[model samples]
Target: MIDYGSEIAITGDDPMMDFRADPDLIEFIEKLGRARNHYLSLTRGDFTLLYENEGMAVYTRSYKNETAFIALNNTSEKQEILIPTDKLGSKKQLIGLVNNDLIKEQNGNYPLSINGEESEIYIVRDNHGLKMLNVIVIIAIPIVFLILYFYIWKRGKNNG
Candidate 1:
């Protein structure tokens, strides 16, 4: 966790790391969390307002076409924050938590939101093998029935 009132440097290839704490950053984080509905359990205690000269680093992650918010306090004090996880667009990774918690390289809980507003989102990963199995089963049923139908029809015709 970053101190509530300190300068934090985010070095990465992420385009959102603008290194500015203006109202826009705060609004962007809030809006992203709301739109994505990633955190449905977020509450008022989750966020704390930064006074002038106080700022924090808001980290975001994208995975499996979902977004996650990780609010880090760079200030000198621990602040309650209400970070919006929905506005992250198609990213996945929870804020304030490491990536090893939720899914592989995923962190934090679901239904996280800003200021107690539920971000109606739930995260889940799909196994391709299961999907393929279901498809094969569904297709095989009809194919087998067709083959049996032809075999019986030919046998009856020859016997007659």
Candidate 2:
């Protein structure tokens, strides 16, 4: 079967149609479609190489308002890459778009791990803000209320 269009046509160039396609081909195509969808929405900008060592390369796609970090493990083995503080800007965490993995900043380094021949896109964000907010709400507010109550009680007793 051939698929035709007007300009910049595909011309049925997909060779997999000529032979016995693998049973998993459908699922694989679905996965590829999902990745393509994500790329269209999240990765539309100038790409900058962030880190490269041995068999892995990390990059960030920037478009004024949005930025996405992508790490690729080209080799057939697992890779662990340590991203330094300079490349991280002020972001403290990487939230995965595909695998939903969360990589946190530890001691100024972001630890990245990827499986053999895999890639991941991440959204950078800060983890410290919520922590400080928790401390203020759970710890600081109660302490201030307790001090005020104690002062009023002491003043009332003295007057009585």
Candidate 3:
């Protein structure tokens, strides 16, 4: 219900509502809420079915050059599937934004095993988060120096 900006309404009628009394359930809900609210692409993104089979299906939601890869296992048993990624632009890794799972593309495909009926969402991107941080620092240094230089120049001009 999050995709396309649909409101997710939870009432007392849900089958899982019985767990409302459990702290574990509340914790899980909190985590899910964080996952849903923290990611803008998950709420408003272009949806595409990447792969599908009788036992499982894989899809993606993308926005602003970012994409979330979602996988669902429909059967009660563990199912393994290879998601072809040759067509997904330059994405080489899928880091779980909430699940803490890390997946790397292999031979232009991603192999995943889902346990029972479960769903996983991964942010499709290169494992360059740390690199990006370094890049940010690198880019900021010159800009900061330029700003300081201009400020000092202006102050010196006013004083003179």
Q: Backbone clashes in each candidate structure, one number apiece? A: 39, 0, 0
Q: Write the per-residue lDDT of candidate 2 for residues 63-107, one digit (tens) a residue.
A: 665667889899999998888878876556888876788988877
RMSD of each: 15.1, 10.9, 8.4
Tell me the spans in candidate 3 whose CA falls farther than 4 Å from its real position: 1-20, 129-160
Q: Tally clashing residue pairs in candidate 3.
A: 0
**Candidate 2: count of backbone clashes, pairs at least 3 residues apart or interchain:** 0
Model 2 residue runs over 4 Å out of place are 1-42, 128-160
- Please list the C-alpha lDDT of all candidates, in the order they appear: 0.43, 0.74, 0.75
Predicted structure 3: lDDT: 0.75
Error of 3 at 54 (Å): 1.9
Q: Indicate the residue-level lDDT of 42 in model 2.
A: 51
Q: List the candidates' TM-scores in order.
A: 0.24, 0.58, 0.64
